[model samples]
Target: MCDAGLKLPPNNEKLQREEEEVMHGANLTLKLNFPQYQSEVEELSVKSSTEVGYVKLLIGQRKGITAKNIRIFYNGTQMIDPMSLCDHLGVSPPSIDVDVYINLEHTIDV
Candidate 1:
């Protein structure tokens, strides 16, 4: 995926007429989602939460791997089952590519 290369939003107190129109137009537009394979995501697990594809790419750019391989593990032991990897990772299929969802990261649930 290409980086969104999104620019910063205008500060609320200083929007010009043109800036206001652009911001409103952007808000009115729709976004699309792209599906990802469960098998593909599952294949990259260094213990579910960690993805091998991500690691491989990182390693290729860093220390290095000659075989171009990936492995899964539960806790510290090796795992071959996709279910095992997914169970720990909670991966969902047909994932959303673009999100308009609100961020709840800093919100307290209690």
Candidate 2:
């Protein structure tokens, strides 16, 4: 390996591009309309697996229902679980903070 006598050029442009990519994640809009759950949630942080669990538990408390029925949507994709969802979307699970939708079925209009 080269010592202090030699150094490689830094890639400032590459680093900047990476940072911009990280901030380019999409936002989701959840529409939770369960009458029993009067709690309002404009955003939910989901950055990790634990955060996913936290969201699931939080939903249970607010909606008085289990997490099984909870499904998240972003763009045209359906987030069914924490791992697959986060990995596929390249988004920190916790960074997902948009209006949380409840009791609304996802559909595509003609």
Candidate 3:
């Protein structure tokens, strides 16, 4: 597992252009579901350029959990921290509504 808080400089112009292109004409929304908690479903309005790890941090603050303890899943798979929300959704303009599951269980190594 990689550090979720790692930050990288935008050294490639092509990547920046691609990111802007995906976010050009759409509003992104991330619907977060917490199965183990009673909190009502939370929705985050974001851009396609938004990072999944950032969303996890926001969820952590709202739920009183550490950001490292939060795991985001889209379409039943874990999301990489550095990937943008749009890439994870794999839509050209991205869906206005994106659903992500929040897992709070901590992993243990034997």
TM-score for each predicted model, relative to the true structure:
0.22, 0.40, 0.58
lDDT of 3 by residue, 9-53 (tens): 769987887677655534666766665565556787777667778
TM-score of 3: 0.58
By the TM-score metric, which is better: model 1 or model 2? 2
Please, what are the lDDT tens digits per residue for candidate 1 over residues 1-110? 99889888766654664565343321121122112222222222133233434433443343233214433333444433323223344333323112111122432333
Clashes of each: 1, 13, 0
How big is the positional error of residue 85 in model 2, measured in Å on the Cα after superposition?
Answer: 5.0
Error of 1 at 38 (Å): 34
Maximum-lDDT candidate: 3
For model 2, how big is the CA root-mean-square deviation?
9.8
Best of the two (2, 3) by TM-score: 3
How high is the lDDT of residue 78 in model 3?
A: 78
Residue 9 C-alpha lDDT in model 1: 75
Off by over 4 Å in 3: 1-25, 89-110
lDDT of 2 by residue, 2-96 (tens): 56696766879877755654664333333433333466444443334333445656776666666654655555455555443345454443354
Residue 10 C-alpha lDDT in model 2? 85
